[model samples]
Target: MARRRKGRAISGVLLLNKPTGISSNKALQKVRAMLFASKGGHTGNLDPMATGLLPLCFGEATKFSSYLLDADKAYIACARLGQVSDTGDADGEIIHERSVPELSIEQLQQVMQGFVGAIEQVPPMYSALKQNGQPLYKLAREGKTVERKARPVTIYSIELINWQAPDLTFSVRCSKGTYVRTLAEDIGEQLGCGAHLISLHRTHTGGFEAAEMISMDQLQQVRDDEGSIDHYLLPADILVSHFAKKNLSAAETARILHGQDIANTENLTGMVRLYDPEQQFLGLAEASETGRLMPRRLIVTDETVTD
Candidate 1:
């Protein structure tokens, strides 16, 4: 028999303003400890050098984190010109340096525009990417270099936010798997000078926005003021807000809860956020073309949650 996790079975999502100098997992652990939640997970990782919106899911919300992980992301990235780092960011050793050229915003925009579409981006060596079951970062730390195939990544836009001296800042909306650090290095190379990421701040990921993010201090204040932080958490269904919503009658909900398929009358198909007639969130279901609604994932209790 497996041991059950001991803590509050609290289920919801927290938009954390992840501070720099800590790993995403570390930030998750801190918030989980504050909430006393037994389970917690993050949608995507923000490098220690980067800080911004990091969505932390707890309890049943962890089940839908993959949807947020696959969602698009936006970041405010600042790169320093005339230098290249081994890790492609300020965290690594500088291996190359050169004088920066006097460049106009127009020239910078034109060069950045070249990357604002379907393009190839090579993942950085100090990244969490794995090869031969070992993380590439581990090999990088061991003074090893390996050939990495360029993968297709879409940069929806790279809007130049500022260009002050040797520092250049831009906001990028990109598809999943786009590495902003690599993009900065490529831009520097295009300008005939080397470059490296100095700072990166994520502003958006999936449906969550910067406006929804709460810093660690803010969270502590909330707990200090209110008796509990539970009111601040968004419902778990918000993680899968992309899914179509369907309401089930009491009888249908009962049948589905008992692990039985029910007939679909609304002709809905694909994954859906299933709710009880009273608007309580039940979990998820898949409606097939054959007009059958099958259980995909369900909460363990009748007193789970409402939409």
Candidate 2:
């Protein structure tokens, strides 16, 4: 006999304003416990020292979490010049210090402009990136260092928001894998002064924004007052809202659900969101150039058509 899973089958996405000092998984677990969700996962990892806008997906939403993982991200980061850390952030030990040279705003802006567009960055040793099935951070703690190849990442935009002598704050919008800490360190090196990240707060990820995020305290209060967290959940379909949507007839919906390709009169190519005649979200389908809509990821509801 198959063993049953624990917790309720809650399904939806929670925009959590993750607080500092907790791992992303820790936040997901806490939210899962609060909602009594059977299965939950986070779109990406936010360092324990960093906080803000973490999307937690429960139940069927977990299936689409990978799409968010590859989406763009934005952050407000504070870097302290004149010091370098072993881990590139405040969590690491200070390894070196340098004298901060008097720099004008124009000079700083000029340096920031240089980082815009495609740039190569070596992954930090303190990162979660694995080498030979071992996380780099684990090797870092063991006093071992390894060579990492420079990977190309796009920095859509970087604007200096505040500057207070040794402390500088900047807002960054970049591709999925861009490391703000490495950018900070590289900026410092270019300025002829060592630096380390003092604070970081992700303000946006994918289609979600910080303004839409709820804090843990607020979530707890809502749970205590309302006795249900389902009210705050955005539909699981919101994850793929960026794609073109194709509504299907009742017959078409049934055909697609049964893993059968449907005629693609619309001739749309690439991934698309599929909806049934009643406006219920069916799932994702890929439109091939050959005029066929192929089932990609389908949701299972009581109304789902079976073979």
Winning candidate number (TM-score): 2
RMSD of each: 2.5, 1.3
Error of 1 at 297 (Å): 1.5
> Against the hidden reference, what TM-scores do the models get?
0.96, 0.97
| TM-score of candidate 2 versus the correct structure, residues matched by position | 0.97
Candidate 1 residues 24-93, lDDT tens each?
9999999999999999999989999999999999998998888898899999999999999999999998
Q: Scored by CA lDDT, what does every candidate get?
A: 0.91, 0.93
The per-residue C-alpha lDDT of model 2 at residue 118 equals: 98
lDDT per residue, candidate 2, 19-132, as tens digits?
999999999999999999999999999999998999999988888899999999999999999999999999999999999999898998899889999999999999999999
Query: Worst 10-residue stretch by lDDT in candidate 2?
Result: 298-307
Cα lDDT for residue 72, candidate 1: 95
